[model samples]
Target chain A: MSEKIDFSHVRFLVVDTNRLMCQLVKDILMMLGCTQVTTARDSEKAIANLRAGGYDVLITEWNLKPRSGLELLDWMRTDGGSPDRMMPVIMLTANSEVEYVMESRDKGVTEFLAKPFTADGMYRRLVSVIARPRDFVSVKGYFGPDRRRQQIPFEGPDRRQQKPE
Target chain B: MRNKPQFIPNRGELKRKAVNYKTGMEIKLDEATLKKMEQLVENSSAEFLSETVASLKGLREALGRAATEPSARKEVLDHIREEAFQIKGMGGVFGYPLLTEFSKSLHDFLKELEDLDELQQEIVSIHVDTLYVVVSHKIKGSGGPLEAQLRASLKAAVDKAKPGTKPAQ
Candidate 1:
């Protein structure tokens, strides 16, 4: 049986240097019936809040003060002091190019929401993280959600032999 | 260091805690909620405009100081790039695509520059000025033909501003 997703209890930590952007995101989250939303202005403050705990997801910007959001995400995913490595991250920023998306994906971002985004877009991403979580993958020099999105079918015996890492 | 690959399934605590029987299974965006979000942005339009104006001022000031303050030029350029990047992001959301497009040029120009030359500084000034025009007039979306011409001119300026950038064919 399928399950219903609710947002009223999920805690969120939004990090952005821009006041308006942060407020806008907070307002949108509130509109979606999310009761617990917090905002931080920079990566440093974000890290502090994360360390303090109680956040289920992080929606951050690409540009931040003192340190960029990518740096914060790196720390979250790889740092020994990371609060929750599995916390979903949505990289929302003006960096909407393919390269930026690829970089964020490689860094373990759960979703990428480019700036000029719509309310529906934000809602969709939130639902995705809550309802469609990906399995985590850890390997040498990498740890993140599974990078592969598709599964291809191969008929007959396996064509390649592989040694386990 | 270990090379073993490990797969960990997501713990469904978030989902379990958020699940409700009355809400149903099929997920969909509520139109009324979206409308409310739009209204919220609309309510903040005035604030966005003022903040954008302030951002433009910040860009102009940083660019201005980069010329007079040699010792602080690097710091100033970094500030300008950050402010420009911010404008490039906010303008579109607040209904000023032209401003975003214009400042994107400024951001790109300074993105790789450790130091700026005379011509590059001029290019930065030009972009900041263009952003001012857009913010002041509240030019929404892509502007008219004149704005298009301005965009093309800025593109050419960015390309030629570099020492060895090839001319577009």
Candidate 2:
């Protein structure tokens, strides 16, 4: 049985310096029936808001004016103050460089958005991310009751599942 | 639900291209007319600059209106298409290749406007700004060197635009 997605009570945090972009995304999200959406212009403000909680998903620009989104993600990974990685982050970037995509993957970013995406494309990515498992812990040296790290043994003959830290 | 009736092009649609109500004489862009156009550019006045500014202001107003009202947006967009097409034809005839090229680009932007979401508005606004500068220079009779600036700005805007899944090129 397929489950119906309910976004009426969900909240999304959008971070981008462009006024027109912020408004446009807000409008599109509203059209998608999202309620209680918040927007941040820079990484600093976005980090602050992220600490405040209540955000279900984050849609952030790759190139921000003050600090880039990659820096923000790095800070979140290093900072012990944030909650255990529970929300999905969608990086909106114009950079399609292979190096950038590889960096994003290494950092554990959930997904990426290329420049000039359509409304439906944005909607679909959001839906897919929301439905996926949100268990991600970016910190290297962290072990506590909140941490739910599980190591699965490799079954295949050749492939190996790297040991957990 | 009922569908609106569609009809073929009437006498008005088939008529020759001219401001029919303005005067009975067709305004053809001949060599003499091209020379006169060149003269119009040479004797640029503050009023001419103001007139171009006024047109840009109208376009800005139309964009603002389109942001809110769907029907009004459609009407304004259609008007822009018609005006831009006319401008493109006239610019080519007058040997203003830059004007013709920019007008064609602006027309493409306007055509693609409706298919874009709100997030794309920033780049669209930048395009509008560039067009405004082009128009301003045209009015000043000094658009000879600004072509490079306009093209670079346009490329930058396009580069910054986030790619959509639908391939919004």
lDDT winner among the candidates? 1
lDDT of 1 at A100: 95
Best TM-score goes to which candidate?
Answer: 1
lDDT of 1 by residue, A1-165 (tens): 455667787899999988889999998888777889999998999999999999999999988877889888888999999999989999999988899999999888999999877767777898888888888777877778878778789687742233444
- Stretches of candidate 2 exceeding 4 Å from the true structure: A134-165, B1-169
Expressed as tens digits, the lDDT of each residue in B15-50 for candidate 1 is 888876666323675577677877887788789888
The residue-by-residue lDDT of candidate 2 on B16-81, one tens digit each, is: 221233432112223553344344433432333354456557767777776787667567776566
For residues A89-110, write the lDDT of model 2, one tens digit per residue.
7777644457877676566566
- RMSD (Cα, Å) for all candidates, in order, is 3.7, 24.1
TM-score of predicted structure 2? 0.45
Determine which window of 10 residues in candidate 2 chain B has minimal summed lDDT: B5-14
Question: In DockQ, how does model 2 score against the reference complex?
Answer: 0.01
